[model samples]
Target: MSSASLKTIQSHSTRTTPMPRYTMLAVLPCLLFASVVPAQADEHTQPMLKRLAGVWEVEEGMNQGEEIPEKELEGTIMKIEKNMIVTYDREQREVYRALFTLDETKKPVHIDMTTEMKGMPPMKSFGIIKMEEGDEFEICYALPGADRPKEFKSPKGSKVMLFEAERED
Candidate 1:
């Protein structure tokens, strides 16, 4: 082979050579780093999310300054999964289902809710949640296109819903 041709072949062979040692060295640090990294606060650390997992009864509810009677919420069940929340009606028919994310980094804890109902596009709602004195917990969320609520109080005429719930444990 010519000198130039030999050099070209050598370069091609090097390029095709397996990088076993280098690959292992590069991946070792990543494995170690992943093992040592602590988990960030997710739904697991968000007490409200954990406490909200089980069945819940709407103790009190207010929508647009109108008080929602308990009977209206009777047999209503709120179920929280890892990253989803579901609500069922008296007949155990699902009324609403939402995927949510929690940011404990925010004071009062920020909650983003996305509800997908049948035949409708998903709706977004910004909310905050906090535990009350006892087993009671309150959540206030703004309707789609509305800004995050500053407080649990829903202003009149605004698409806001403020409600307190008790775990049905």
Candidate 2:
């Protein structure tokens, strides 16, 4: 073969050859990470929340074409301290925990917490809850930043909880 022809053929073969196995191995992890994501939902659970001495409840929702029958989840809170709280429910599969601070009005300000369902968007909301007479409570600025604050009532009494929703505006 002519020297130039041989050089051209060599260049074509080099360009078409498979990459080294080590290079492929190094790229596999990156490919997996591109397709895989770590999921964090229940930042905490019901039994986890029961540490706070209070009341708790859960309301059920319905699916498409289904009716939401009246169902209540009875829960209780066992107070751990002035700044810490936990709640547990009747079924006890769920628990919630909260670390609290204070607002200017001295209202309880939630610093951050795990009183939310799994599969929700990662979030932290600051708000206060005040209890009134009867089975009533108020979430001021509660679920404020969140599009919807999931609600739950305390079984021991009425420490109504409104959790941040999994949504980004």
Per lDDT, the best of the predicted structures is 1
- Model 1: per-residue Cα lDDT over 1-169, one tens digit each: 7989977877888758645768999999999999988877544455666756777777788897788888998887787778898888889999888899988779888899998788989999999988776567788998899899888897778788898888787
Tell me each candidate's TM-score.
0.69, 0.33
Measured by TM-score, the strongest candidate is: 1
How far in Å is the alpha carbon of 130 misplaced in model 2? 1.4
lDDT of 2 by residue, 1-169 (tens): 8989977877889758766779999999999987775454432332222223344333332222233344433233333455654545556554555555444344342234434445655445454544434333344233324422233332222223342111111
Candidate 1 has a TM-score of: 0.69
What are the runs in model 1 whose C-alpha is more than 4 Å off? 1-47
Q: Summing lDDT over every window of 10 consecutive residues in candidate 2, give the lowest-scoring window.
A: 160-169
With a 3 Å backbone cut-off (N, CA, C), the pairs that clash in candidate 1 are none
Tell how far residue 163 is off in model 1, in angstroms: 1.1
